[model samples]
Target: MLFGAGAGMLAGLACGGGSGDDARPAVLAHIGHDVAAPAFATLHERAGALVAALEPLCAGPDATTLAAAQAAWSEERDAWSRVLPFGFGPLPPELNALDFWPVRVDTVETAVAGAPAAADAGYLGGLGVSAKGMPALEYLLWGEDPGAALTAFQSEDGARRCGYARALAVDIEARTDALATAWASEYADALATAGTGSAAYPSLKAGVDEVINKSIDACLTMVKGKLDNPLGNLSGAAEDPSLMESRFSGRTRADLQANLAGVWAVYHGADLDAPAAGISVLVAALDPALDERVRAQYARTVEVLVAVPEPLTEALVADRTAVQLARDELDTFRRLLKLDVASTLGVTLALSDNDGD
Candidate 1:
């Protein structure tokens, strides 16, 4: 679930305590109650809206209904993007079920051909990763064009596609609802109780370290998974467009922005509304100058992302300079995050073991 950026810098705020003050407990509480719980709530709500939006489209398969469903999908996806920064514990499994990309098209095709009785949660949940989730929905809704997809849904065999799409939405809704419940009830306590007489973590520092680890992973994903790999930086040619996140919808840029939003959420310790004590406060207390540098870097990264044109798949090929510029700027931010923020906070990043780009 962890991803990164949003507006309003979390820097420049004053801290009452000096470098020696330990605010990990407070930070964890704020993240659990204000940040993670609320993000899951929003995800559940938006997912519900998507399920409802898809109902009419599946039944009628018209352009108007298809458009409505697409809009709902974009909203739900943005909500999911904001939720990415907390992609730890239960979130990762749910994310794999919901947004795993480069979907196994053949698997999905086979499932649709079989035509299950209903697209209920159990049925969809039992299906393979590539055969279900948002990516599959993207394939169904945006295949060729909305109009053509709708026409296919109206054909003699259209019921099968409609059934699968409905099932996918229902499964997503179920997973999000389960996530919200788990975070609010079970995981939030574990996070809030981190470092204090807890078996899960030895110290409050451990909890904070988890946040740092996820944040760095989000930054790494931005630099490597999202941009460089797809752009073919190693091979000296852009890879297939299908490699890009949000490739079906051409909203990869928005996904990148949401990545930053997740980072912003963690940096600020809360979302825009609930600004409780966060890593920023700890960093400010320890080294205010370093804090300012990290914030400025975050702002610069957001600015670079803002400048990149939409439809990132095309941007990778035709507008290589713009994509490269954004990537370079994000790389700088990632380094600052690793060097200054993590160092000053006394945390270490555990880079992924899997070496493939």
Candidate 2:
């Protein structure tokens, strides 16, 4: 039961071309080469820039240097967010190692205190995921207060704190570099050649299903984990700002937008009007109206999300209505992909680890 009764009826009427085997290879190639490879490369490049920016801040803690480092981190975060849809390849194993969120303040603080004066990769490798990655770095770079953050870097333990931050940046740089290399050198080909001798995907449907399932997972992450938890929609309790992601840096909204952008990239290809190849190609070929509906729904979701107030943490308490509106829109978008589009493709929906209320 991948679809509901209504969705099954829609599938029966819309899914005229069977499993869309003929259009899969082109879509896979477009996503692997054009969308994912470039995104990971940009992430790697931004990771390097983050390291470069942090070096100056670690050397001399100043307002200008700190701002530069924060900007660099934001760029890297955006790049990482845009690749959220491509959860296969080298990404799955390294996921937590790269961006574990709801960052534990105590864990990071302990690591900063215990770390060597000059923390390096070996030292960072011994630390837990809570003490490293983008979220941890966000805590280090932009703590509760901007002035206090700078003063802490200029205090007695400044060297150690800055050293730990540098080490985290290096760890991120290494991981992103490896991810980009793996995708460009090997995984891209494996995905593009799916069902035609690629061992990763035994059939064309497997590859397409992987893409669709990951997209659905991304949506679920936004609706349930990002929005619902923060809004306290999962529990019977009131809104909990602490549950919000990217709260330290106040970039939760940007992160959600980037997640949707990644999904859109998978659906519409690199460009919207003149797509090279995307899931839209297969869907439009089978049912043009469904494709149009998906496109419109995606646009509506983005629009509502943009209307929500910034610093999603505060919005969860003060502007809950706007936030809930955005969440509802995202759930609608999720249903379109999970039900209509998946059934139309004859794709068997797979359960992701993130799948839940």
Candidate 3:
């Protein structure tokens, strides 16, 4: 199932013929406009809402305001998860800024202690990645318990702590807004007109290759970075609950579910029944049987993930089998994309820095 083995098998398979070539422009257009653009828009909107919620809570640290802010953060986090498949364009540069995890509590606490009373964007800009993204905000909002988080906000350092959280939210909103604007104003054209005087891509094949390869990388991220690390698949030691994403809010399961949904959006479409021109169009045209298998495997993977109990930190200890089953299903999904679908599309798979065998 390694990519080296997949590349060897690809040498014997035929390239996706002229029809797939002809469909590239439409597919790119659909993905650019119908899929990526809207996803970023939602993320931007949700980030704005997060800022709004955080403002009132920072001004007055109360139970109701805290709940509202936490709910807003969850919504923004899910919106972000859905856009995880498209790692190109304006995403890569801002990825760490927007969602860096395994949050360093010491960094966040130190930053908060030294932050100005106002804690604006400039102050946040000077801080490191670990102290200012979604994870940091989750720690601030949820803490060890809702009561403790509220008590801290009402303590002598309450204003500084809340101000720092608000600053982080503001930074996230600005970044997401820039991402949405970039995709809509310029990057979409680069993708849609690829191979037709589009400087970003030399050929339609190259454009499609980027899309399929990113999808593969996203799957790999979910399988390894998100699931395997916490499950101790990489360390070959005891499961480490602290490695889980969204651990502070107990939303790790929701995050993984949203990630798989994002991958499915690329493989199928935004809609399953009436399908838009996602990579699925070219994939189905080039190899229908493989398409069906991918579709089925994706469903199986999501189903198993949903079955994993909530608060993935505890699940890693109590329900390790369910989590591992979900990971195995996701690995299979990644293999099908990296091996069969990429070969069918004649895509040149690019190596990702995070990729492992």
Candidate 2: lDDT of 183? Answer: 92
- Can you list the residue pairs that collide in candidate 2? none
Tens digit of per-residue lDDT, candidate 2, span 1-116: 34555444435434332343466788888988988899899999999999999989999999999999999999999999999888888898888988888899999999999898
Model 3 Cα lDDT, one tens digit per residue, 89-159: 88999999888889888988999999999899889878889898899999999996658789999999999
Alpha-carbon local distance difference test for all models = 0.77, 0.86, 0.86
Q: Write the candidate numbers in order of decreasing lDDT.
A: 2, 3, 1
Candidate 1 regions off by >4 Å?
1-21, 235-237, 271-276, 354-357
> What TM value does model 3 have?
0.93
Model 1 poorest 10 in a row by lDDT: 5-14
Q: Rank order by TM-score, top first? A: 3, 2, 1
Report lDDT (Cα) of residue 23, candidate 3.
65
